[model samples]
Target: MSSSHDTHAAHDAATSHGAHAEKKSMRLMLHVWRQRDPSAEGKFVTYKLDDVSPDMSFLEMLDVLNERLIAGGDEAIAFDHDCREGICGACSLTINGQPHGFESETTTCQIHMRRFEDGQTIYIEPFRANAFPVVKDLVVDRGAFDRIIAAGGFITARAGSAPDANALPVPQVAADAAMDAAACIGCGACVAACKNASAMLFVSAKVSHLALLPQGQAERNSRVLAMVEQMDKEGFGNCTNESECEAACPKGISVSNIARLNREYLRALASSD
Candidate 1:
């Protein structure tokens, strides 16, 4: 005995409720690399995650998985993370064979779960390089980069108050290039992406940032020489110009910096002779 108007209203309400119930949770199969320590052989462990939210970031999704593991009295998976804001570059995860889950110019922390489909199988691992030995499941030793920087990444100016901006008139091109190179967070993505596992991109970016500045002019020759030498001594492979490093870099550090590195090295050799 309901009026037609009431019937339509009920239908509308039912439709709304149906839509609300349709937001089904996403589930994914994760094959995570687990290693007890540096000497232990790593293996892929399968884990099923049934409550993944599309709104959660990749790192947040991992946090949920970890919570479940700990609640179940299982050892939590170890991974690196800092700032969770994409600036720290500590979330080093190779998602499905890609450095940062195939996102262009985006780090792992910047990638959200919505990009992946339900029932997708995700394979996560650490950055592989001889210089960057696996420290744990997903953590690797990146101390080699620190040593390369220490070799010659600084300008040995007298410590004092900030110099006047007008004291040095750097060209617009040089300033822009320097800023681009300085954007590198030392993530080692370049090494992970390169077939030869070269550290050229990272070394070149570090070299370019200082070489483009006026303060870096004093030790230009020596800085490139020392940094390159340290890079070689660290067991990093040689650059074959495959351009994979530039493609995998979250900062989009250009391969042109590698060319600049070569030129600087040549100049250093010529000057030394």
Candidate 2:
């Protein structure tokens, strides 16, 4: 063989060896629940993964596993994700009994494999809440949150020539407070983490955001009353003063918002008669 062809062959062999080595280096065990459908009984299935890069995000690791499953002619694990930047609140999972696992002030999509140790077994589960019914493996229908919002959480302003943003000159403190409440991404981590599955944190975050702002002033009384009533109607348990929701909140929304919601509800009822 010509020297040029021999050198090319040698390079290809080295490259192949390197790829094989990398694949061999990946090692971990994932115990994921397999639920064919909401009606189907689910159970934990063990999978041994090798050559997994520690740099990959947690969701990306799951993607790799799904690809392997598909190649093996098996059904892929189901999970929800959108944007993958921790902003959409679509990726919801409970890792090792903690919402969003290792990431602080972040969602499941933002958690990376670096948080885990090599050869460790990871347990992933869907966010559990009575109001959030499981649709598939690691995916739940959070439509309850939407219905609660629809009750009266938004301004009634219609589309038109929009008013100037600075026209109302909101106080800095109030605007900051409003922005803080608006930071909630509706991921339902607060609900899943709460022992009673109370949605007070989620509901109050929405209520307080608007209630603190002048634009939300007109419907203040009605909004708080309606939203809280809807939250209760959804069958979510009442907050029992346990602060689990606060600790598990990805957005770190304060429990004080719930207090504000209660105050607003009482005021609304007092004035209605």
Best candidate according to lDDT: 1
Name every residue pair that clashes in candidate 1: none
Instruction: Put down candidate 1 lDDT per residue, 1-273, tens digits, no spaces.
Output: 112334553454456557654445689999999998999999999999998866567888989999999999988889888976667878788899888779888888877776788899999998889999999998899999999999995687654898788987999999999999989989899999999999999999999998998889888999999999999999999999999999999999999999999999998999953
At residue 207, what lDDT does model 1 achieve? Answer: 94
The lDDT values for all models are 0.87, 0.83
True-structure RMSD for candidate 1:
8.8
Worst 10 residues of 1 by lDDT: 1-10
Candidate 1 clash figure, as a count: 0
Report the error of model 1 at residue 208, Å: 0.3
How do the predictions measure up, each by TM-score? 0.90, 0.88
TM-score of 1: 0.90
How many steric overlaps are in each model, in order? 0, 3
What lDDT tens digits, residue by residue, belong to model 2 across residues 1-273?
Answer: 112433553454456566543323348888887777878888888899987765567898999999999999999999999878778899899988888885678788776565677788889888888799888888989999999999985687553688788777789999999899999999999999988999999999999999998888889999988988899999898899888888888788999999988898999999863
